[model samples]
Target: MTVPAHHPAPELLLDYAAGSLRAVQSLLVAAHLAYCPECRAQVAELEACGGVLLADLPPEPVSDSLFGTLMTRLDATVATPTPVPAPAGKSLFPGPLRRAIGAEPEALEWVRVVPGVHLSAWGVSAGTASACLLRMAPGSRVPAHRHTDSEMLLVMKGGFSDEFGAYRVGDVASYDTGTPHHAVADADGECLCLLVQDQPLVFTGPLGWLLNRGFRF
Candidate 1:
């Protein structure tokens, strides 16, 4: 299982292996694993490591009926498939990304960034924080810049490259807003990424600031 040039760090896989990643985030990781068998082995290895650690641990005291109860539920589940969390609405959004962000999911209002690039701002009611869905035309590149807050880039389709490495479909790039970098795409190929961010975007130049100010979904 060859990982991309810049794959999620081991910490992320540990979180996933521990089931700490959110469902949405986990969904993307599952997709990435589909492409990377080496990472798959690594995850399995990690899980095995965890299992060994558990083997040495003291067994938890449990009621005698615990085994029977577990078997009962496992038997029942065989007949009924569990429901996947999808959008609850009259009509679902047009894309996988939209549907993945269900539960009072915001709309994707395309706002022009450059001639070939677009961004859709998404807001949440609980916080001033928001996110975005970004699209870039083949070969287009956003100005290299730094972020002020943490950002999550989950690729739904296409790919991009930066100083770190190239990211293809199903890849996620998490960055610290305090750090800075530049990203670009291959010529004539488009890439769509779900940008989950909570802080303001720090533009590197005049146009960048203007675009950020006017950016809205």
Candidate 2:
């Protein structure tokens, strides 16, 4: 994929630097950073600012028993290192996402969302949000839907387009509750993306009703 022209907003980058973004949001940002050097520079600057702030804080005295307590715990315990996930060959997912999903994209079992559209929800639990890989057949059109919470879509293969603009590989499309748009996959090939939603979508119209009945979001 070519260098990404679109990126996560500055506010999102700041939140990421501050460790205030939700887990999935952070993962999305990390994946973008892997492909975007400009954003990586911005995040590095933010971290430097945070380091300066930390250095300026006044030091506090430690409790009298703190040293003894730490020594006793250290002597009594054996720390086990955390296990790391192995790479799944050539994959579109960045490190964090690969760790979360634990397999190559082709290995996942996808469920049909609608005709010509399928998805594989993240195996791990999400806090107040949901993350998944959505796959759309060439020339397919996703039903028009509006969000109840924020949504971020990062294209990993092929392309898709909505009213905002066409998004190719490595491009990101973010939407808040008020932005309602239907996406159509490019006719050339299937479109694959990692989609993170802060809350379930509130799809519009009769078609939405049927879809909502069959699927939770």
The candidate that achieves the highest lDDT relative to the unseen native structure: 2
Q: Compared to the true structure, candidate 1 yields what TM-score?
A: 0.65
Q: List the candidate 2 regions with Cα displacement exceeding 4 Å.
A: 64-88, 123-125
Give all candidate RMSDs, comma-separated: 6.0, 2.7
TM-score of each candidate? Answer: 0.65, 0.86
What would the per-residue lDDT of candidate 2 be over residues 1-217, giving only the tens digit for each residue?
4888778889999999988887878888898887788889999999998899889989788999999999999989887688675646787777678778878878888877788888785544378777788899999988888888888898888999999999987788999877898899999999988888888777787778767753474
Model 1 deviation from the true structure expressed as Cα RMSD, one decimal place: 6.0
**Lowest lDDT 10-mer window, candidate 2?**
121-130
Give a tens-digit lDDT track for model 1, residues 1-217: 2355455668878888877765545554565565566678878988898899889999989999999999999888766567886754553222444455553223455677767778765533224445557788898877655677767676656788777777877677888767676678767478877676656677777677677665543
lDDT of candidates 1 onward, in order: 0.66, 0.83
* Winning candidate number (TM-score): 2
Ten-residue segment with the worst summed lDDT in candidate 1? 91-100
Error of 2 at 84 (Å): 9.8
- Pairs that clash in candidate 2: none
Off by over 4 Å in 1: 1-3, 23-25, 64-109, 120-132, 152-156, 170-174, 196-200, 207-209, 213-217
